[model samples]
Target: MHIKPIKTEADHRAALARIDELWEAEPNTPEGDELEVLVTLVDAYEETHFPIDVPDPIEAIRFRMEQQGLEDKDLVAFLGQRSRVTEVMNRKRGLSITMIRKLHEGLKIPLECLVKEYQLVK
Candidate 1:
């Protein structure tokens, strides 16, 4: 098993192919070790070259709502009222600390995502 730093897209592709071939390798063996190293290297390269930015706070909330089949009314428990939910979702108002905490706990949205700064609709 041979491996090198994945620099170019071609190198990335080659690493992926190798990983596929070694995917069935049993653990505690040379092939398994090579597969683990290749997977880690591929992940690192992708993160550096194609970093994904965190979702906007409002968008994150909307995404979670969709995932959980929730509506604006459901958000009242986490937010306050229907109007407040609309305002927050529309970016007409910002999330307060209390709202953030509730959303994090109720919706299982990460605090890091909730605290991210986003431009209110202007």
Candidate 2:
């Protein structure tokens, strides 16, 4: 086991290659242990160097709406009235805490996506 911290892009690439090689490693074995450790190190390195931003709250909502074949009218139960839903979908309004909770509960949109700070259209 020659594991090292993935500090550079080259190191990241090598770790990924190693992960591919170990993709079929059997569990409870030395090879699998190495694979797990390498994957953790690579994940930590990528999280620092190649951080991914959370999706915009409205966009997340829109994506879920699309996935579930829902129209704006369907969001009224979570977002309030039709006008409020339109305001939210148009980016003219920000989600209130209550709306965020309702959306998470009713639509199963991730709270992380719903709670992210997003710019409202002026």
Candidate 3:
């Protein structure tokens, strides 16, 4: 099991091929141990090379709402009146801490996504 820091496109491709080969390795065995280490290295490399930022809070909320077949009115239970939901969704207002907590609890939106700073407009 030879693994190294994935520093370029070639290294990344090689690591991915190795990962595919190790995909079905059984746990607690020599091959499995190598697979685990390879996976960790791959994750670290991807985190550095292919970082993904969290989406804006309102976008996250709207996405979850769409996924759950919810609408603006449905958010009233968590975000208060329909107008407030509209304002929040339109990015005219920031999420209050209480609102953030409620949205997190009610919608299962991650706090990390919720807490990201975003412009009120655009």
lDDT of 3: 0.89
TM-score of candidate 3 versus the correct structure, residues matched by position: 0.89
Best by lDDT: 1
lDDT of 1 by residue, 1-122 (tens): 77899999999999999999999999989999999999999999999999999998998998998999998999999899899989999999999999999999989999989999999986
Write candidate 2's Cα lDDT for 4-121 as tens digits.
Answer: 8898899999999999999999988999999999989988998899899879899899899899999999999998999999999999999999999999999888999999988888
Who is ahead in lDDT, 2 or 3?
2
TM-score for each predicted model, relative to the true structure: 0.93, 0.89, 0.89
Q: What order do candidates take by lDDT, descending?
A: 1, 2, 3
Report the Cα RMSD per candidate. 1.2, 1.5, 1.6
The 0-to-1 C-alpha lDDT of every candidate, in the order given, reads 0.94, 0.92, 0.89
- After superposition of all CA atoms, the RMSD between model 2 and the true structure is 1.5
Clashes of each: 0, 0, 0
* lDDT score of residue 24 within candidate 1: 100
What are the runs in model 1 whose C-alpha is more than 4 Å off?
none
Candidate 3's error at 91, in angstroms?
1.5
